[model samples]
Target: MIRYISLQNCPFDPGEELCKFRSESIGAIASFTGLVRSENEIVALSIEHHPVMTQKTLEQLCDMVITRYHLLGVSITHRYELLKLGEPIVFVAAASVHRKAAMEAIVYMMDRLKTDIPLWKKEIFADGTSRWIEQKQSDVDRSFSW
Candidate 1:
């Protein structure tokens, strides 16, 4: 099994990361990419995180998902710092022998990451206003489903 998890400040190409998976035993790969939205007149987003804690939490989460889903490989990349509109913010991919497991794993990982990880986001508006986003009840509910 293979696992790659990173919290980076620089931009990454999700396609390049997807191509890195090379396992003869794998039959399906599922992925999700989160991008900064242009809605609400948002100009940019600033993500904040604790380096050590964030990395440790992500590693643990990846390990759990891999074992639970019997995955051949998984990759998760999350970015911090100021990100412009339409920029990619996160990428998650899961590889398994079956399509169901791979697809489910991606959804599970994203749901967990939304609540379990201690990442803070501030939305910057076109009007030069900014606000720290709070966790929505919907996100909390989604994580509880798994």
Candidate 2:
């Protein structure tokens, strides 16, 4: 499996990264992009992560999904620091010989990352207030249900 995992402080283009996957043996590539929203009076978001710990955790999760799905390639990029509304926060992808495998790998990795990763996010409101985003019940249930 070809896998790339990164936790960085800069913004990234999910579409560009998704276009980078190319393999004649792989039939499909599934991808997902997470973004900072403009809803709920949110102006921006601030993400905080311990670089070393976050990278290690992401790598382990990616490896698990890639191996389990026999993916030809996978790439996951998560961003920290300040992000404005509609900015891309994460880019996830999985390439495999079958569409099901590629789709499942991306979904599983994203679910686990949403519920299990240690990164923290503070949503900055338009009213000059900020609050930490808590884990969602749906995310937890989805991750544990497998």
Candidate 3:
């Protein structure tokens, strides 16, 4: 199963869930969590998405990871709109027949989300200053070279 999730109202217990559904057919599972940090001088973050485009981009990302990594299952969750520091921002889980495939799938999904997704974030400072931050090209470039 695959889904785009919101962390605000969802508990991403992918590990526990995977354990319950484990089979001899599946040998590995990898999970990743991204949390909002307080280091950005921001009191809150707002993520914006262009409805249809975001969903299409995310699905294409998932499909690419699945095809590239030979994953049995892949799930990605990203939080949107105003979010406080320390909140869960993203969750990725992948199941595969080997550890390397699961791990690679998670990494690929994250890279795609950061580079291809149409989501943008605005940082709102405690002092009331708001700034829109573009996804840094350098960050995306680094992913491919690695």
- The lDDT leader among the candidates is 1
List the candidate 3 regions with Cα displacement exceeding 4 Å. 1-24, 143-146
Clashing pairs in 2: none
* Model 2 spans > 4 angstroms off: none
Worst window of 10 by summed lDDT in candidate 1 = 1-10
For model 1, residues 1-146, the per-residue Cα lDDT tens digits are 77998799988999998997899999999999999998777899999998889999999999999999999999999999999988889999999999999999999999999999989999999889999999999999999988
Report the poorest 10 consecutive residues by lDDT, candidate 2. Answer: 1-10
The numbered model that scores best in TM-score is 1
Q: Please write out the lDDT profile of model 3 over residues 1-146, one tens digit for every residue.
A: 43343333333454444454355677888888877788678888878888788877778877878888877777777777777787777778888889999997887778777778888888889999999987788768956764
How far residue 57's Cα lies from its native spot in candidate 2, in Å, is 0.8
The models' CA-based lDDT, in order, is: 0.94, 0.88, 0.74
Q: Model 1: residues >4 Å from true position, as ranges?
A: none
Q: Which scores better on lDDT, 1 or 2?
A: 1
Instruction: Give each model a TM-score.
Output: 0.97, 0.95, 0.83
| lDDT (Cα, 0-100) at 89 in candidate 2 | 92
